[model samples]
Target: MIDTADEFESACRILAAASGPVAVDVERASGFRYSARAYLVQVSRRDAGVFLFDPPAIGDMQALQRAIGDEEWVFHAASQDLPSLRELDLVPPRIFDTELSARLLGWPKVGLGAVVERTLGIVLKKEHSAADWSTRPMPQSWLEYAALDVEHLLDVRDLIADELAETGKLEWALEEFADELVRLPKPAPAEPWRKLNGLNKIRGRRNLAIARAFWLSRDALARELDAAPGRLVPDRSLVAAVVAQPRSKGELSSLKEFTGRQSRTQIDRWWQAFVDGRATEDLPAERVPSDALPPVRAWSGRRPEADERIKAAKPAVEAHAEFLSIPTENLLTPDHLRRVAWQPPEPLTEDAIGEALASHGARPWQIAQTAPIIRSAFVHAAQASDDTDESAS
Candidate 1:
């Protein structure tokens, strides 16, 4: 492991002299740690063999960045690793995502191990994939597993790229990878506590407020202790506490879910959470305001005409996707379909529908195939509306 700045510079010198695209992978402590920082980063090249760096110990990587500035980085899932890599100022100018390429080629199983096994006839062992990388004195077997991740990435990329070229989908794959590079991280949810697994089972706004308060306290404690929020207190216990609404420390201590050693030690802390929750002035809203269109399945009861429009538009999209041999979602997203059907653009001509699709992030190919179908559906709905008005008169 290249831990110190001096060791990192030596590794950078070696990598800078190598001649080929870089294969990159990272190991993170997802459930075991509070942060999403990369614990270990592995990079391999045709000439460089393989190199591993401990990111936490090597504080600055400007030299390493300079070495890889102009090379194309290959990753099994580029988007998943890019964010953590970016945290260390390691951004690639060009990238190829094998996972995205496999999806474009319509491969059913696109996992790293699956793709390598099928394409290169190499079956990778995945035993330590979920092990805690935050532990010191890293095991030799785990390090070997990490190294193997990037060993055949270059060969995998070549074989997949060749297949994409033969099938005339190379441009499509490039477009998808470019989009992933520029894609922004999703914003944190407004009420993260409400997303707990069993929160929906809790009744009443009052109980929800109590559960939310408990979740917030647990989250703060987790951060302080550098542990996962779920590890500090499970969602099931939060929901149970809300249901029981225990008024005293004694009552809260008697709950089965709170019988763990940690929970027992933190009995007063848990009791205070309940106390503050019951006394909070602003209880959480039962339902947050939403700007999104309602579910398509609910359109029948909410608006029959909108339902008619969606039913008319779907078959055309399905036919086009089948003809082109692509997934229905890749052809046109359901959210885009629903938005257009709910409130179509004015004039509802082929041109207007085309612009609408573009604003909704549809590619040129998708817009060309889906615009006409959506226009026809809206036009038919308009004619039906006109006839209904005339008959009422």
Candidate 2:
């Protein structure tokens, strides 16, 4: 294990001399800190054994960056680690996400442990899953866990690459990797109040207005306390509080509805704000429209002919996916399948269908095999729907 800056630099020099790909894995301090930062990074090369780099000790990763920056770096679930890597100003030119690659290749389990076991015939221990990676002077077991992550990644990649080539799906994997490199992490928006479970049932504009105010107040307090919004004040408590409309601290306290930190820290302030806000508001309570909710469809209750078509198409799609060594979901999502079953687009020539499939990220080989069947099934569904509509009219 490489711990100090000098050792890390020396390892980078050795890795830089290699022409093949390098396996990369990162361990971050996620739960311990509000921001995700890499505490440790493990790398493995074809000739070189595993090496772990301590980000804090190294101070700067310029040498390590230069080594792996140009080569195709393989990672499992790259998105989670990409943000922390970007923070250090390290930009990789070529990237391959083994998880995405496995999913694309129809592997049921895409996790690193599972992939390693299945593809490389190695069973990785899971003792370090919940360990504190931020702790200094890393434990022996943790180091082993970290080492195992990248140790078999290169071998796994080789096996998957062969499968991709045999199935004529190598281009799909390349396209996915290219797409992965351009993605960046985005901050989640502050909309805690909007996620209330059943707030829509409360009658009137006034209820919604008060609920909105309460939600904003709760959010502000949560942020101030550095606590999760639900931890600060649950939606149920807020909804109940709004319904009761407590006029004072005593009334709010008497309700016995809230306990813990929210009651002790925020109830009095929240009640006062609600009372003060209500005095100026004159809007009547309004009922939220039921139609605004997402429509629920019963898959089994659909028209028999449509159901038959969908059922018939499933095995064919699965077979094609298996033959291509890619997941069936990657070819088309369930939602897309439903759309094709219920409402399909107009007929197109084979070439146009192939182009459309390719544009949607399907490999050339996949398009060549599945496009004709998909297009025909969709056209038939559309015509049938049109006929039914005309007859009803």
Candidate 3:
């Protein structure tokens, strides 16, 4: 509950004096704001005690960073928090994600709250789950909730780590964490905006071009305003606005869907941008071509047989998964099953099939359990298809 910068620095110093791994949690206003930045950071060390950092109050995070930089910190789901921590230039040398550890050890549910409760026999209060962390003069309840999140994280990590070691899955957990480190966020393609609601009805390429222009304009405005992008211009309104092709501010404002600040401040520039965008003639075609389906050769034409086999095998797979208290998808993907159902059975050896599964990231134990069923399905399909071809000849 300490709000002063000096108190925060002293707390961080106390944490740095700890001998073992630290546990961390972050509260961010992502959907509530234009920028997905951490508004609060909470950390707890083995001996020093729990600390909740108000990111706005302590603008510089150098002290906190230097303290935890070399320590083996444990986070429930590191990937989500790592990015936000990176934004603050606080990079930990080593990280163990408890959720990923649980998944690697074949836990049924890997959610933070679930893992923590299951591992430590403690229930977390979710009262502050949706609280806006960016607000100044933070509520006492929110501070308590934030502290509680990291308080038990070290205990959960120790329990999960011991479980992983006893189960001989420590290497597996390490591999999973290594894989997570490389999966840092990358920007995605922008074309999928066409499939957004109402935009699909705007048939021509010109209208789509106008929509793209307007969408980009709104994106920039949202960034500047530090508001959610949708608040600046909703997807449906953008579509409707473009479709109307309003040439003047009055006409733009007259559209039933356009209202509030968008109708006032946004109308003129948006209209101009759309009009300018429409003037350009070489916009890409709005509609995805009908001939875009993969070629017949690319499709495993044994889809019907594959479907039947998978449907028949699903119950057994589910039963096995339930018996083991794990998800069926973790054992074998539907694509793997379908591929096995449609392939030739020249390589009848289980080792060969196991190797194939390994290539697709299946664990050795998973391949060992599911290889027999997969091989049998392949043999059955191969025999059936061969008989049909022989009859035709």
Best-performing candidate as measured by TM-score: 1
lDDT of 1: 0.85
Candidate 1 local Cα displacement, residue 38, angstroms: 1.1
Per-residue C-alpha lDDT of model 1 across residues 105-155, encoded as one tens digit per residue: 778788999999989999999898898887777898989999999999999
Q: TM-score for every candidate vs. truth?
A: 0.91, 0.71, 0.78
* Tens-digit per-residue lDDT, 165-280, candidate 3: 89776765675676566665756545645545677668777877887777777777878878777766677777877878786768887888875456467677777777767887
In terms of TM-score, which candidate is stronger, 2 or 3?
3
Candidate 2 residue lDDT tens string, 1-107? 57687788789988888778888888985544334667888889988778888887787888888887888888898877777888777677888788887887777
lDDT of each: 0.85, 0.72, 0.74
Candidate numbers sorted by lDDT from highest down: 1, 3, 2
Could you say which candidate leads in lDDT?
Answer: 1
Clashing pairs in 3: none
Q: Which prediction has more favorable TM-score, 1 or 3?
A: 1
Question: Stretches of candidate 1 above 4 Å error?
Answer: 259-261, 376-393
